[model samples]
Target: MYRVLIVDDEPMILKGLTVFLQQSGVSIASIRSASNGEGALAAIREELPDFVFTDIRMPVMDGLALCAQIAEMDQKVQTVVISGYDDFTYAQTCISYGVKEYLLKPISKPDLQDTLRKLIQRAEAAKPASAYLSVAKMDEWMAEIEQAIYYMNQEQVTQLLHTWEQEIATYHMQDEQRIEMLQEFHVLLMKKLKARDVNIELRPLLELKQGMSFHTVYQQFTGSIQDTLDSLYRRRKGKLKDPIEEVKIYIEQNLGSEVSLEEAADLLGLHPNYFSVMFKQMTGETFVQYRTKRRMEYAKRMLGEERYRITDISYAVGYADHSNFTKTFKKYEGISPSEYRQKMGI
Candidate 1:
């Protein structure tokens, strides 16, 4: 079943299209109507519709702009332009925006049905290929990419990106699929950095431009990741006694043992109270909170590997009591360790 959104300035046209499509025998899951492009955009952001039928002229945010925005958001959304004017310029604009169908005002029911049938067929044909990697394989690929980034292995990272690009080309993926894959990769990169407790500005990396070439996008994104990692590395080199950095390394290396605030403070050769205040000031987290977060992250990574029993994982991450480990894992992750492993398809 598919969700469809219809947009027009005319209430009657919107109502008519909504009713017609709902009853058009097209397996519609839901039908929504919007009187203008602005409202349609809001609805799309809330829940992207599989199909959009929109008029060209509206008071605010014309159909051409709306279609362009939709293309940027998701290229797979099937769009049909219903316009009263039969202007060549409007048709050309819609064509550039990838509108699949254009119908004149007072569209015939049969014509609409034909267009929808063709769209449905195209959508079914465009489903992810059977040979696409399974979830577990994808997760492993992402982990390898993250490891490459962690070690500042630019050669490996570039080779991996090239391999991915070749794979996308081999599959002849559409622009929509390419964008989706890139976005997923970007998300995994950010999550890996976060799990490592690296703080870096990501606004430029996140703001994807419409119609950017895949090569250019990948270069910029990978460059940003490398730059951020280099910056963090340099900072560490210049500040070997950096308390936050020390604590992060210590926590990761000692996740299987009890790492207390006083112990960490003593390692830094500072009074416990002073170290506590300094740790909070430097990392914006208390010692216990930071250690727990790192342990949880380590536990999650182990869970993704699928070899360890829950009880063994609990002991591995420093919890002596199985129930206590489960409780803390649930508190940190909002799910038990076993549930997390299941969700990861382990």
Candidate 2:
């Protein structure tokens, strides 16, 4: 005979849940409803309910804020968050507030019934709740993990993970709780990798194995994160030493010559078409555009120096025709070479 309160902004949801629970054959001593968290808090002040089923997004106050208030006002009253969002951060926040359950929206009858049954059984047994990590502590750990990943500090990450496992052992966390925490940590790791443009598929790494020890699972998780960072580092290092980069250097050194795509590709032992596509993808510009831009930049610097005549500067930048060089320079710089030199007071 547990008193229950359902809080949601939707009138349909509030009415539907109330009716469904009332007829579910569960021993709900009394059921109440509120349009939002504010109303729910007001109702609780009037008469504290044994359980609260709340929607995460509601007017005036959200379910997370309500859960925090409940934790402070009455730790005995259990809460179950119902939300459409499947975000791991939300689950982590709710768990920190001692939320008994988190049910996704479009809630099924069986899930609701099962959640209710578990809460009722706990209420009947009168078992004391176990201590869990505080929200602030969990946040601190997450920030440390993020910082480790940002700097690719594998040693720091491994140490932090080992410390986390020890914490779980100290707390005597249940199997379900351990898995949930790991899953949330996996989400954070994947998010960090994605921010750095590491596009590896994470599903395989995130899957929890059956009958594996928590320490083993955590080691594997740490390995996966390390593997991703290693792969990204290797790829970046390889790019610096690759033939494509050599081709770029060659282009810069021969800016005064007729640098052709075919010649550059041949130097790298690649087909011209393939090299063209790869260069565009990597540098975000065509080979001709890059060469032309570089040549124009060099021309401007030489013009400012006034060491050579305009005709000599034009030939020095791979332009054999003075009229053609002036036309191209005006196209890119909005002025002829002589006009640019005059403007620069050369």
Q: Compute each candidate's TM-score over C-alphas.
A: 0.37, 0.37
The regions of model 2 sitting more than 4 angstroms off are 127-346
Tens digits of per-residue lDDT for model 1, 272-325 = 755786688678889899888888888888888867888888899999899999
lDDT of 2: 0.78
Model 2 scores worst on lDDT over the 10 consecutive residues at: 195-204
Q: Roughly what TM-score does model 1 have, to 2 decimal places? A: 0.37
Cα lDDT for residue 50, candidate 1:
86
| Candidate 2 residue lDDT tens string, 55-171 | 999989989999999999855798999999999999999999999799998886668878876777666556444555443355467668765754567789889878877777777
Shift of residue 178 alpha carbon in model 1, Å: 31
Model 2 lDDT, residue 309, Cα = 92
**What's the CA error at residue 337 for candidate 2, in Å?**
78
Candidate 2, residue 311: the lDDT equals 93
